[model samples]
Target: MIIWFTTLQIVVAVAAGAFCAIAGLAGRRPSDFSVGALALVEVLLIGQIVMAIVAPFAGNPPSGDPLEFWVYLVSAALLPIGGVIWALLERSRWSTVILGVIALAVAIMLWRMQVIWTVQVG
Candidate 1:
């Protein structure tokens, strides 16, 4: 994984998570802002997916188990989708809070993926 790109993803994810959490704490229901924040995270994950595919060919393949990295990548991609859908269906303040939790989880997962990609040795 590219250090810069991973850092960017982590920053965005944290910001988005905080935004959602604050909104939820303020008793706000699921709104465009909350949903959009998660959507942005999802977009970043999509970019990561593309990067993962290309990085290997660019001679930056994972130093750890490729399967582990792909598992994390795929699971991270699914999180925002589930969160957004839950928010849409529930349309509650807690749903917004759930979005926050999902975003934070994504950030942690991304960090782990970075380790799997570049830090861990086979």
Candidate 2:
């Protein structure tokens, strides 16, 4: 995992979490802005996938265990897509909660990916 991309994912996840928390606290449904943010996160994740694929050929393996790395990559990338689908189905505060959960999970996964990378490298 690229350091900068991982950092970016964490930041985006945190922001999404904050938005979800605030919406939940207000007893409001997810807004278009929240959906847009989630979409942006998905876009970034796709970019990360592309970078990961290219990194190996570029003479760098971001993660030593490509299988583990791809597992996290695929899972993390799917979260946002799943969130959007679920959110569309549930438009209330529940959707916001789902978004929050996804964001938090993705953040954790990113951290795990980094740890996996470090362990393999060391």
Candidate 3:
């Protein structure tokens, strides 16, 4: 569990969420940049997935419920892809808002996964 890496992911996730939210609030459908930001977030999520897989081998397995941790990881990874598909179909500012919500969910999920990775409390 790398602190700075998690922080970077959180920042990107939050920024994507904020960008989509603001665009939606301004009555704009998802722009190219919006999609790009989400894509970036997806890339980070992929990185997280890799980290999760390799960490166990590195002797840094999750300290909490492994099932919960894996669930968060998988969900966070899927959120952006789902949002992208939804946005493509909806084609409205509302779609952007939905994407915004998804991004926020990813952020929260990532934070939870981090806790599950780093914390040892029962």
Candidate 4:
């Protein structure tokens, strides 16, 4: 994974996660703003997917097991979707917090994926 892009994803994910968490703690219910923030995170993940597809072809293949990288990528990509679904179904303050937690988890997973892509040795 590209350092700059990974950094960007982590930053955005953390920011979004914090925003949602604070909102939930303030007794706020799931709103468009929270969902939109997650959508943005999802968009970044989609970009990461594209980059992952191209990087190998561009001679930046993973130093670790490609399957491990892919599993992380796919799982990270699903977090936002699941979070949104949970919010929609639950429609409570806790759901908002869960969404925030999911975003944070995504951020952590992205970091792990970066390590798998560039640091870990197979």
lDDT of 4 by residue, 86-118 (tens): 899999999999889999999999999989888
The full ranking of all candidates by lDDT, starting with the best, is 4, 1, 3, 2
Q: Candidate 3 lDDT, tens digit per residue, 3-47?
A: 788999999999999999999889999889888889999999898
Instruction: Score each candidate by Cα lDDT.
Output: 0.95, 0.81, 0.87, 0.95
Clash number for candidate 1: 0
Global Cα lDDT for candidate 2: 0.81
lDDT for predicted candidate 4 compared with the true structure: 0.95
What is the Å distance of residue 90 in model 3 from its true position?
Answer: 1.0
Please list the residue runs of candidate 4 whose C-alpha ends up more than 4 Å from where it truly belongs after superposition.
Answer: none
Q: Write the per-residue lDDT of candidate 1 for residues 1-122, one digit (tens) a residue.
A: 89999999999999999999989988999899999999999999999999999998999889999999999999999999999999999998999999999999999999999998888986
Q: Ten-residue segment with the worst summed lDDT in candidate 1?
A: 113-122
Candidate 4 global TM-score: 0.98
| Over 4 Å off, model 3 | none
lDDT of 1 at 48: 94
